[model samples]
Target chain A: MDQITLYTWIGFSVFLVLMLVVGYLSSKKMKSIRDFATGGGTLGPYVLGFSFAATYLSAATFLGYPGWSYEWGLSNLWLFLAIIAGGPIGVLMVAKKVRKLNNGQKSLSLPDWLGDFYKSDILRVGTGLILLFNIFYIAAQFVAGAKIFEYLLGMSYTSGLLLIALIVVIYVYAGGALADIYTDAVQAFIMAIAGIGIFISGIVIFWKGGISDTFAGISHELAAQNENLVAVFNPESLHFYSIGAVIGAIVIQWAFASAPHLFNKVLGLKNEQDLGKMIATYVVVAALSVLVLFGGLYSRAALGDTASAADLALMDYIIWAFPAIVVALFGVVILAAAMSTTDGIFVSISTVFANDIFLKFLVKRNIVKVSDEKAEKIAFQISRLTVPFIGLLALLIVIRPPEYMGDVMWIGISGIAAGTMGPILQAVYAKRKAPARAAELSMFVGLGSYLFLYFTGIIPSTMSAGAVSVFIGIATINIASWILRSASSSEMGAAEEGGS
Target chain B: INEMLSIWLYGFIIALIIIGFSLWKWYF
Candidate 1:
């Protein structure tokens, strides 16, 4: 109806049409599952590098990061640092090991790797549950993107969600990994450009009137000024962890990077040698993370008290605080970042559910050592169908979202960090296998504790209470394992001496 | 040649050991 609305819809529609064409072309070449999920393991260093980066980032980075930085001041940068740590470390530490294990296999998903690791159908099934949790998180991202479009363009949220969803799914389904990779490369470029442009505009706003005067303008009308309206940090404030924030940041980032969906990107790398480049790329991207942090802080300084809701603050700045063209560019960048990430998570969740849970239990119970071609193709087909189903389910839940996109996501992360990270991390690091019973018990305890804490609101939402619970669960499993191992070893030693 | 190298290695080790003992006491 309105000029701005008309332009916004037109821009979004044109973008969607181009994406659909690309997706259609991508699907034509999708002969197998590897081609669907991992870009056929043939993605070059550059595409692979950016695709991986884009997959980890989302609207959360674009919209959520600045909102968070705006609210918490410079202290919020610590969380960004924690996130940056997770990406590079996961790539460096896990890449070689994952490649060696998945060796020459065209596996499409994380569950495929986990299924191989435990050599147990049951473990794969449990991993599927974890993947489902990941799906909830991904679905939220999709909903967030739609919400952004609806608010900015004055379209109905439902319509915007469906419009974006249709375009993303069509492209991803048809093009499979090819379309996802190519588009992600393009999106990454757009994201960088948008970040630089918006950030510069935010700076210019501050230059027009520095923080001292901006506060003076707002200080008259507003009583009890929001303490976080500035870029400065204060030690006495509870805005940062004090001591807990530092420890919490370290623990959470370690778990986030090690998340199966994020780490599975390693399996998609072109070669073992390419890992060096991947790690190098991660370092650069990690530094770029500071850009989002500064952007949010700068925007906060520009808007002052007028920036009420943190989530929409960045978007509001782009729309009202800048020119029409910058606003359009911002929308494009957010859509690009959000779509690539949402698709990756969607594909991952479906693949894990299909291959790890359904295929292992229902379809092929006795198949022990399936190769990449068989596994990847079968898993990918399952994911293609299931992703839309999962997307629809997410759509239903997001109708009245819990709060902002970042809030719901953090809670979901807490639930996952509590449930899966403990046992998985223990399994990886201990050089000793958890007893079957112990692993099962620890998972139950960790998952149950996290849910209890989240639902009851016993744990402050500030710290990663879920990751902490995971650590407790892991400790329980290791202690049990230690006791059992010691008793068995001593008994064997005594028996050998008697026999001699 | 292997034996000669081994003897040289022993001498270098003795001189290094003298330096290490001297440095350790001085630093402490």
Candidate 2:
């Protein structure tokens, strides 16, 4: 009934209508499970590029990360720098190879690509199971969306969560990956605009004379509040306390580039030729998107002790800095950021379940035998059905959301990155086939070591723990492969000598 | 203050250079 709420409703309604229209159009194009999963491998460079960047940016980038900047100060920028450099590099290392590999097999999902490449059903199913951790990441997005709705529209957290879940589930179920990609591209554009707006608003609020003066003034204000706040490596901070921790952040972010939802964007590109253009677009957009982090430092300087909770810092700043109409429009952009990632996650999780677990594991093994046509139909239906099922699971977690949305999301991200990064990198780049046993061992080591380090507080931060685990995994695979190869060769030599 | 500012500036400069080199080598 208030002006802000009224405008927000109007803006959000328009966004929802546009998204549903795209979903409806895309639904008509889904003739097979592959079409539902990977947009029939026909998306253009810009669409896939934007979708990849948008999915990576998410509410964490806009809402959660700004809060980190507000809480921890300039030290948080190291993580941002890591993402800027690591993301494109990760994509460059994998995208063209992934696209070429998938072209031959027409694999519909990340797990499917790995499983087929390694020729192991166990690897496919194991990776599929590991990716289910994305449920936690999705729940974190819901918490973010609910927080924005609670702040902007004065809706209860529960109502906001339910509304976001309902909207995302309906569209993704109807249109699948095609709809998710197109909407994600649009969302990425809006997020880019909002990112610029956030950065400029910080300058507009705190312009002393020029850019240098503005930054110095802000730094002085923060140092006045707490000298540790402006430190490049704040000793009190958990995430960026030491040089080791900063390097850990970079390594983990590089590993995150291999996450299923982000990496699988390569599968939708029309061909390898489009890859350079796609990666170029993604790098530019991602570079722009992270500019929103400056809002954190700005809010910290402006609000001082009165700043809201860490996750709420950016939202509170937006409310305080802008007028009602701009606030309302920003509300839409924030929702786009949250939904963009959530929908991509939904598509990725569903594809893993239907394609990797159900079709490949069960039908291929005769555990659920059926004619190929019937099996495809069942898998497609199952994939569509999975949207609401996982949405409901994630909704349950959001009902009792964690204290830090960003940290909670990283719990899942760290696990997936640690487990998959080693095997995936090796699969894409290795000249000789990595032993399937080595891949499996590396996954367990990566995941197990990450859990041990995280829970025991040895590493003390999820990103650091995940980074160490990734190295352990890569090392495990190489050692195990070398040992196995040597042993087999020795056995062959011994048999030849005995025969002579 | 100068130290902090320099670190920030240099951090970004190094990151941009790495990204630029990567783009040229792999993407361009």
Candidate 3:
């Protein structure tokens, strides 16, 4: 084998072994469903914080988004800005509230929280079902890992996909949430190092005189290729062609904090007091990670026409800029980025299936009867079984591989964000008990509108469709709630008048 | 030097401020 491949194999083997060891150790502590789902809410700020940030900065952010910046130039910075601001905003708005609601409870999943909050089984089950859309998002992560493996290790896409799936499933199944959090924290550190390395490398490559000069040089080079490339809102681009589109991108991304895998990190915190530190850590790490976007502009200016496909732009730059050993190590970092998010997502899907659907809904309804202890054991077993099931489902979707990894992931993201954003915001912040009917309507309208717009090509940009649907969802909830409240009051008044 | 690049810089700076303020508010 070549030196790069040999180093990569060694790095990957070591990383995988460390992860499996953590999983084995964590499994020993997994006595209850709570332990499996939320690490029994004993995780400190650093672990929860790093795991949250790592899950947020997925392969899509590290790999796919840079490719976008390479293709569209500075316009992609709008999305980055949204991400930098949105994450903290989402946490500020909801993290404390979620922790308060879940305090002293047996680790509530997002769906379970919603169900209990609204007192509606339908809402919980609906939310759980909507979260399943993450299967596609997980598939996108597989595609990204496979792409890197194909480029660096000369592995076939299918081989890489299966390999990643097997490794992720083994760890997640063994240790559940504890294993996921521990490994994700480690992965987050690796990602932070890689992000800093890539960002510094880009600056060093284009260091004409200083930062401004570097950007000027990149702008000049890109402008020479195509004037539109240097423009803030590339008229030719689908994602950020206008101010409206940029706003749409921001709106949708802001709601991305509501994603189950990302937001549920709050439930893992040791206490509500740790929330501030956790959010602070997450913001710092996420900000650092986003600097990697600069690699896109660097690659575009430096490689020019010889740059590889857009999705591979950053990878190409890494290979060209670094020595073989460094490149091999970066291969592991990229895998960390991919698997970190995928593993969190796997735990989430399994938890929802076992905790929300099977135990809460079915057993509570007596459709599946057992003693309480037996039910908990059954839920734990079912959660473990779900890891491979989801891995297999996601693997099937990615076998063909989509044209753009970002788009494939966005398909699921837009749907989930659209469906849950309104309800979650209302549930967390509303003064009164948020009407269940209103949440139900919001979810249906939000998800339905997004699917209609996405599949029918009505909006042309998934971000725009997602944003519009989120607005519709929020509107539907407010309007439906007001109408219901008024009607109920009127009915009460009439009955009182008749009784008098 | 490009207008778009300048806008991006400003936006990034503003984003940093927003994030900093958020952290301050949450902590204090």
Candidate 4:
């Protein structure tokens, strides 16, 4: 519509071409399936660290977080703190053990890791089902990215979704983990720059209104919500449910990076020491990202009170206060966030289906037993092709994108959080090892509960279903483990006495 | 008295150096 808009498209087109070229070049060297899936475990810290961070922070953070904060006022700061709490704890606790276990096992996906840990095909298949849930999750990311493009660039949402899906498929399928890591490094840098720019611009607006006046405005606006926005904690309020929602957010954010795609990055680290470094670096960087969450609150306070505030909060301010160039640049930043997340999800889903599901179920089914080398190679090849197929699947699913793309993305995140986090935490850290049977039971219970809540409409609309499901799932696992362990201990004592 | 004290201090210093070096190499 205008010169700046034309220039923005031009820059995006150039960026797209550059990514394609990189993808093509990276595809040229495909000596083994290992190379495709794990970058032959040669990726340096720069790629490993940033790729991990960027993949976790999707368009949901870039667009949806700010919008939600805008609607809720500064009180949503609790959610930001929740993210900070969960990220470091996860790194210090879970990551090292995962790295040690991954040694010598060529795990192309998270389910592959589960298979290695449990030494059971059934467990691996169950993990694959969990990954399949990510297909809808990844679809949500693509839809959100496209909806943003449609809203800002005047393109049809379908066209935008298709374009993003195609790019992700080609780049990931062609270059595998190599392209994803490199592009991730670039995307991470772009996000950091974009985040800083938005913060500074938003700060300038507040500065113009003067600090005191800004607070006065925010307080007045928050008054409509009963002036409880700045009051940090109110135990007996509807906001109480929302505040409690922070715990679920914390668990999900911490575990999201440890999902199949990103967790595989742990194995790709050069050594045990590097794994430690990755954890520390990732935790620190991730902690800093909480600032963006605060920036969202600041923007909300600056914007006037309105009911439809969530969707319009961030963009509304940018569109009005900034020049066309700055607005366009911010759009690109959101685009990068969406693409980084969707691409990782696409790669992860493909890896799970190809490596764990198809290779185990279809390709290697006839063999009574398979060699490690053959298993690794087949899993790698299947994983390599999975990227594009997943992209195609996402393209189809996202054809009719949801109107509330942000909520859709969170729903997907909740599915992973509830289904996987409960089982993973138990298997990794609980003093008693959950039997494979118990873990499997937890997965089903968690997934079933989430679906039930969604369909039955029993839970409050604003609360995350994953929060309730994970709590229930963990309870189920602990109870089952206690009963099974007690029975096994008694049987073992009887057997020992009989043998003596 | 001086020799024993110095020996104890030297061992502590060397231990600290080794631990510091190991951590630096591991993290950075």
Most accurate candidate by DockQ: 3
DockQ pick, better of 2 and 3: 3
How would you encode candidate 3's per-residue C-alpha lDDT over A74-184 as one tens digit per residue? 788877777877666777777766666555444356688678767788889999999998998888888888887887889887898888888677656555433456667
Error of 1 at A120 (Å): 2.7
- After superposing candidate 3 on the true structure, give the runs of residues whose Cα lies further than 4 Å from its correct spot: A25-47, A104-107, A176-178, A258-274, A369-381, A494-500
Between prediction 1 and prediction 4, the one with superior lDDT is 4
DockQ of 2: 0.52
- In the order shown, the chain A TM-scores of the predictions are 0.81, 0.90, 0.90, 0.82
lDDT of 4 at A29: 52
Candidate 2 segments whose C-alpha is farther than 4 A from its true place:
A25-47, A96-103, A176-178, A259-274, A371-374, A494-500
- The top-ranked prediction according to lDDT is 2
Clash pairs (backbone) in predicted model 2: none
lDDT of 1 at B18: 46
Q: Give the per-residue lDDT digits (tens) of candidate 3, residues B3-24.
A: 7777767877887787667666
- Model 4 CA lDDT for position A136: 73
lDDT of 1 at A24: 61
Return the lDDT, model 3, position A494.
47
Candidate 2 lDDT over A1-500, as tens digits, reads 28889999999999888766656655565445445545526678887788778767787667888888888888888777788877777777767666655556766566877787778888899899999889989888888888878887898888988988887777566553334566678777777878888889888789988988988898999999998888989887778899899888888888888653345667655554577778878877887888888888888999986754788888778878998888888878777767767776787788888888998899989999799999999999998888889999999976875667888788888988888877887877776777788888888988899989998989877888889999998898888877877787797774221110
DockQ of each: 0.01, 0.52, 0.63, 0.04
